[model samples]
Structures are given as C-alpha cells and as structure tokens.
Target: MSIKSASLTIVTPNLADTRKFYEEHFNARPVFDCGWYVVLRLTTPYQEPEICLMSPQEGMQAFTGGAFLNLLVEDADELHSELTEAGLTPMMPLEDHPWGDRGFGLLDPSGVIVYCYHPIAPSAGFEEYIIEQS
Candidate 1:
C-alpha cells in the first residue's frame, strides 16, 4: 500500500493558540477550521496538509507532552534568526549536532517541540548512519 499523505492531529486545550503558532512560524494556512478543529498546510510549493489541532472532545485528552516534530529546511540559521526576531525563544538553542544537522527547537502552544533543521556534514563517527535514498 502506498501512502499518499499524512498529518498528525494533536488534541490541545489551546487550539486557537496552537493554530496561530503554526501559521506564524511555519507558513501554515488552514484548509479546514471548525471552531474546535483546524487543519493546517504549509505554503510550500508542494502545499500539503501537515498538522491538525483539535480541542479535547468528551472522550479525548489534551496532549500533555512528548511530541517532537522535526522539519527539514533549506537554511536553519536564517530561519532561526527570523523566528528569534519575531519573539520566539528556542527551547533548544541552534547548534550543530553530531548526528548530522544544525537545528533548534520551539515549544508550540500545545506542548509539542517543533525542531527546525538543515543538513550538515555528519560528524566522523556518525557518517555511517547516512543512507542514500534510492
């Protein structure tokens, strides 16, 4: 089976704030919004839905913690600068990782850690983990 697309829906107590956070930082636009639920898609050339935010319904529970969304960008430093100037404080400061990228993290309103990064040369011992895509 082939997966055409996918999105992660997080139950959040702050649905509006979560929606606004993604819109401002990730160039996300809502494809659907119904007071308690919002689906957001990035305005990249591909324009695919990437995130969904929803209020906790009767049987649902708000996300407490432990979700990390990693986004690969063209330039991490540039985006980090822009986000910093926009008043976002990084939870994880921008730095090169021995695992092979430069990145930083921001906490969204719904308790998700959004990590933005760009590829960098892998540190010596980590090079073996890079797999070429066929």
Candidate 2:
C-alpha cells in the first residue's frame, strides 16, 4: 500500500513558543490552531509534511525534547545568515559534511534540534551510500 501522508507531532509545554519559532524562522503558517494544539506547514501550495505542536493533555507526558528535525532547504548559508540576524543562534555552525550535507543545527524553544541543510556532494567514501532515484 502507498502511504498517503505522514507528520510528526511534538507535545510540549512551550507549544505556543514552539509554534512561533517555526512561524517566524521557518516560514511556517498555521493550518490549524486551537491554542493548545497547532499544525504548521512551511509550504503554501501543498499539504503533508507538517509539524504539529501540542500541549500535553491530562495524564500525558510532555516532551522534554530529544528530538531532531531536519529541514532540507535550497540555500543553507542564506538561511543561516537570516536566522543569525533574527537573533537565533545555531547550536552547530554551518559546515560541510562528508555525508553530503551542508547544514547547521539550532535548538528550538522546547530543546529540539532543528537542523537545516542543503544538498552537497559527498566526500569519496560517502558517495557509495547515496541511492540515486530511478
């Protein structure tokens, strides 16, 4: 069976702050918001690939954030500058990786690692692992 869509939902006490972080830094728009829960999307013309932020419900555990979110963007350096100018600091500075990524990491309000990257050619040993699409 083909998968239609998939999304990751994060439960946090800082739901609003997290939502705002994504909205301001990632160009995310709220597709759904009910104060305690919010659905955000970075793309305007498509659905799916959403990030959901929710306040922990009664009897539920809130996320303390050992999560990582990877965002593949067109220009990592430009986005890095923009985020820095906007007063957000990167947890990991922008750099090229042997694994074919030029990326940086930032910690969100809830302590999640939001890594933003762009594609780059992998170093020799790493190139063999990349699967080319048919």
Candidate 3:
C-alpha cells in the first residue's frame, strides 16, 4: 500500500511551549491549533511529516524518556550554523557518526529530543554492520 502522509504526535504537559519552540526553530506554521492540540508543518512543497503536539492524557504514563524526532536534511551543517546563530544551543555538537550520519541534536522546551542529520560516507568497519536489502 502506498502511504499518503505521516505524522508524529508527542504528548507533553507543555504543549504551548513545545508548539512555540517548533514554530520558531523550524519555521513551522500551524496547520491546526487549539489549546490542547497543535499541528505544525514546514513551509515546503514536498510532503514533509507533520509534528503534532498534544496535552498529556489522564492516567497515562509519563513522557517516554528516550523518544526522539529525527529530521533528515540536505545540509545538516548549514542548519546547525543557523540554529546556533538563532541563539539556540545544541544538546550535542555536530559530528560524523560511524553509521554514516553527520548531525546534531537539540531538546525542545518539553525535553523532546530532535535530531537533525544528513547521510555521509560511513566510517571504518561500516561494511561489517551493513545489512543487504532483500
């Protein structure tokens, strides 16, 4: 089956702050916004994923500590520079990874990890971990 669109919903206590943080940092525009729920999207022609923010539900467990949003970009270094120039500090400095990624990470106001990355040549020993596609 072909997929039309996809979105990731993050339930947090700080919905407003999380929504505002995405708006400011990613140039996201609100497609829908209520007090409890907000959907934001980047201003792009291609079908990018939507980011949804919502209030925590009653009786639900606390936020998942290690959940992260990964955004693959064309130029991660440029985006890193832009983020830094916008007065935001990265949770992790941009660096090349053994798994063939050059990226950085940041935490939103609600402590959600956002990783911005782009693919690069894999490091030494990458071939050992490579999985052949079926």
Candidate 4:
C-alpha cells in the first residue's frame, strides 16, 4: 500500500522554544501561532512532510515518543552540520540504512524523534522507489 500523510502531536515545557527551533532550522512557520501553541508548515522553496507542532495546555494527553518523524533532504551531512553549528546537537550522525537510505535522527523537547535523510540511489522515476519491501 502507498503511504500518504503522517503526523505527530508534541508537547514542550516551553512551546515558544520548541516552535522557534523548528522555525529556525526547518524554516517552518505556524499557520496558527497563539504564542504558547502553534500549527506550522514549511515555507516556500522547501518540500516537506506535512508536519504540525502542537503544544497543549498543561496535563493534556499529548502524544510522546522516541519514534521518528522523517524529513527527506538531498544532503544529510550538510544539513546536520548546519544544525550542529547553529547549536542544535544531533542525537545521531549521518549513517547508512539497510533499506538503502542515508540518514540521522534528532530528539526534540517532547522526546519525539525527527529524522533528516536522503534515499540512496534515489529514484527520479517514482516507479523505481515504489517497490514493495517487507
């Protein structure tokens, strides 16, 4: 089956900080920003995996996990470096995936994992990359 949209709900002790981090690095801006809570989308010139940032009221049942939310990039090393230089510590470094992708993961305030990546031998023709895998 083909995959479509993916989403994750997040929480932070300080929504402002988490929001700013995403905005600064991924160039994501909130479609709805209430200062304490927001819903963001990546701005022009950047293709993205529709992501939303949610910061609920204290004690709300917000989703939390160590699993990853991935973002595809052409160059993981460069992007990872830029993030590190800007003072964001990557929880993982560029590494080869057994499934034929190069990538890394980052941990956010809510412990949500974010991955930046590029598929190895990435297909320009959709057919090639759509092969079924176990």
Candidate 5:
C-alpha cells in the first residue's frame, strides 16, 4: 500500500515552552493540544511536518535531548532568519550536505535536537523510495 509522510512525537519537559519554541521558530501550530500531548504542524501551502512536541513526564531524561527528528522546510535559511529575528539561537549554521540537503540544527525549548533542512538536490540513491513508505 502507498504510505504518506512521517511525523515524530517528541516528549518534552515543558510542553508550553516547547510548543512556543516550535511555533515561533518553525511556525508549528497545534493540531491537537492536550495537557500531556500535542500535535503541531506548519501552516497551509507548506503543510508537511516532521516533528511533534509531546510530554511524557516532567523530567524523563531520555526524552529530553535529541528526540532525534528532522523538520523539512522550504528554505532553512529563511527559517533561520525568522528564528534569528525571534531571538532564537541556532545550534548550528546552515551548511551544505554532501547528501543533498541544505540544513542546520537547533535545540527546542525542551532540549530536542531539531534539524531544519531543505533538499538541495534529490537524494543520492533510493529515488523510488519514500522514507515515510519504507
């Protein structure tokens, strides 16, 4: 069967702060917002998202860092500019990847490593494979 895209649920320490970080920086708004969990996404026109902020427990150390997700954007540089204007410091500057994604990394309010990227070119191999489908 054909599959769609993927979105990762990242358990965070502070849902509000994490939510604000994503909303202000990446324009991720809540599709579902409960006290313990939330589903956030970018706005219309560019609607695919790759990460979500959720809350497991207040201090589950395992859920704190590198909740290990990448968020694809139309232009990482433009997002960076917006984030800069919003006073968020990028964990890394935008850089070119040999693998074809122009990207940078950052930390969410809850300490998750978020990679913001735009594909510079099609992926090297597996042209037929959609990551969400594989």
Candidate 6:
C-alpha cells in the first residue's frame, strides 16, 4: 500500500505550552486548535510533517525522554544561530558526524529531542557502511 501522509502526535501534560513552543521555534501555524489538542503545519516547505500536540489522558502516555523528531534542513549552522537568537539552548554545539551529517540537537518544551541536520562529506571509513541501492 502507498502511504499518502504521515504525522506525529506528541502527548504532553500541557498542550497549550507545547503548541506555543513549537509555534515559536519551528514557525508552525495551527491548522486545527482545540483545548486538548493542536495540529500545526510547519512553515518551511522542505518537509511537510504535521505536528500534533495533545494533552495526555486515560490511555495516552506522554513521552518523557528520548528523541522524537529528526528534521533535515539546508543549513544547520544558520538554523542554530536562529534558534539561539530566539533564546533556545541547543543540547550540544553543531558538529560534523562520521555518518556524513553536520548537525546538532535540542530538547523541545515537552522534553523530546529534535535533531536538526544537513548532509556533508562522509568521515573516514564511512564509505564502507554505504550500500549501493538498486
């Protein structure tokens, strides 16, 4: 079956705060907004991932730890500067990785790690890990 679209729904204790955090940091605009949940559309057109913030209830469990999103951007350095200027502290400084990525990480208001990255030349021995696609 072909997939049409995909989205991630994050359960948090406070939906409004999480929604506001995404809006301010990622430039997400609300497509749907309710007291318990909010659906937002990322302003950048590079990737169309719908981010949904929902207040945890009965069966829903909030993600208290770990990485939740990996966003590939054109320029991680520029984005880092932008986020820093916006008063968000990156979990670590942007650095080149052995897997051919220059990126950094940050924790969102909900404690989810978001990795922002861009592909670059692979580090030494990284070519051995590459498998040719048919």
Name the top lDDT candidate: 1
lDDT of 1 by residue, 70-95 (tens): 88888999999999999999999999
Candidate number with greatest TM-score: 1
Candidate 4, 1-134: lDDT as tens digits: 99776655576655666677778888887677766667778664655444566666767866556567778787888898898888888788788765667888888666777899887754455446656752
Cα RMSD (angstroms) for every candidate in the order listed: 1.4, 1.8, 2.3, 5.1, 4.3, 2.0
TM-score of each: 0.94, 0.92, 0.87, 0.74, 0.73, 0.89
For model 2, the superposed segments whose C-alpha errors exceed 4 Å read 44-48
The backbone clash count of each candidate, in order, is: 0, 0, 0, 0, 0, 0
TM-score, ranked from best to worst? 1, 2, 6, 3, 4, 5
lDDT assessment of candidate 2: 0.89
Minimal lDDT window, size 10, model 1 = 41-50
Please give the distance, in angstroms, between residue 21's alpha carbon in candidate 2 and its true position after superposition.
Answer: 0.3
The list of candidate 5 runs beyond 4 A from truth reads: 57-62, 121-134
Residues 71-118, candidate 2, lDDT per residue (tens digit)? Answer: 888799999999999999999999999989999999998888999998
Residue 33 in model 5: lDDT? 70
Candidate 2 C-alpha error for residue 97, in Å: 0.3
- Candidate 3: C-alpha lDDT: 0.85
Model 5 Cα RMSD, 1 decimal: 4.3
* CA lDDT scores, all candidates in order: 0.90, 0.89, 0.85, 0.72, 0.73, 0.84
lDDT of 3 by residue, 1-134 (tens): 99888888888888888888888888899888877788899765655579988898788654666778898887899999999999999998999998889999999877878999998878778957878621
Pairs of colliding residues, candidate 3:
none
Model 4: CA > 4 A from native: 1-7, 44-49, 122-134
